[model samples]
Target: MRQLTLDLQPAAPPSLENYVSGSNGEALTALAAWLAPDNREPLFFLWGESGAGKSHLLQACAATCSDARLDPQLASLPTSSGLWAVDHLEALADGGQVVLFNLINRLRASDGRLLLAARLPPRLLELREDLRTRLGSGLVYRLRSLSDEEKRAALAELARARGLELSPAVIDYLFARVPRDMRSLTQLLRAIDQFSLEHKRPISLPLLREVLQTSPPT
Candidate 1:
């Protein structure tokens, strides 16, 4: 019997290079310039639906700049003047909200950078009115989900980067049988590549089927 565990392979940390800019080029461009000395924007907030790359962007921003990834539940925040990123804005507790509220207020005076992401826009979040107002005061951008064509383009690029040759038939099978989200698709792509290498087989629909049969359901 053959068994597979997706948990054995940890996900790669989000980075700027891996992020696919489908309709998000403007927002991504701004974030890529986060550490530039000439950037005058002190705060940046991006909102999108689940799996729309909001959290991914925030994480990538933090990793790129080596900034402090603040905890949304922390009672206190650092006073240093540097970049700070936090995900899931709605999960913030009272203390964290107060701290973040004050942090945004002090960003301009201290020349700091703030990056935030949430499923809802700042005005829609159920937060303090003052905090919501502050959130909107900065540069706000809506992250758009990738269309099917853009995803296909990204998959080709991803496969090329990984040195994997995936035919259109294999990609079609992936779309039909697997979760269509990029994250899930990326992981499954890696899994199939590993399976093919382990079995010394070319990547094909038959191989993907074989792996999918032994592998757990998505």
Candidate 2:
């Protein structure tokens, strides 16, 4: 079976409103409250597997408040702004770990804020014990992947909103054949919409297979 390309098209901009929390609703709620201008929380760490919406939530906060975003590889983190976001912490270098440790200390001293997302939880992170403890010191939230039923409901809503019709069989075909992440599924749906329009064919399993054929092999 041919694989469909999901990353070619950029996803919709990440935003708090667009994120589907599923079982992680409580995490989302706390994040929203933390992003409030008046809130004084020092830091938050979101950890989960890839495609679990960790990046989305952090970016949503940064975009919503114009906060500085820190790179995982940066050794010299910014000291100008109290608000900062660091993504993909698993790739951070040792120098970065030291800088971040000090940065966290300062954030606590000044009541500044930091946002972090990683593939692992703080206790399990391969970093300095102090840094790991500092990361876990804040309100840590683990993002949960959406279940098939939740994804199906979201897809149905997306199809309805776009005035596109997707049969249950096509959706089942997608779940079985393609990546299960919401972002990828959404991209697939868009690709199918465009392909159906171009070929003047009804959306169907055969058409989906045809569309999948157009993407280069993985």
- For lDDT, the strongest prediction is 2
- TM-score for each predicted model, relative to the true structure: 0.85, 0.83
In candidate 2 the C-alpha lDDT for residue 114 amounts to 89
Q: Write model 2 residue lDDT over 1-218, tens digit each, in one string.
A: 54445566667888888887889999999999988889888888999998889888878876322211354546456675768888888877777787788888898678789898888899998888999999999989999889899999888888877888778887888888878888787887887777778789988888877877754445
How many Å off is the CA of 195 in candidate 1? 1.8
lDDT of 1 by residue, 65-88 (tens): 222236555544556747887678
lDDT of 2: 0.80
Q: Judging by TM-score against the true structure, name the best candidate.
A: 1
lDDT of 2 at 39: 89
* RMSD per model, one decimal: 3.5, 4.0
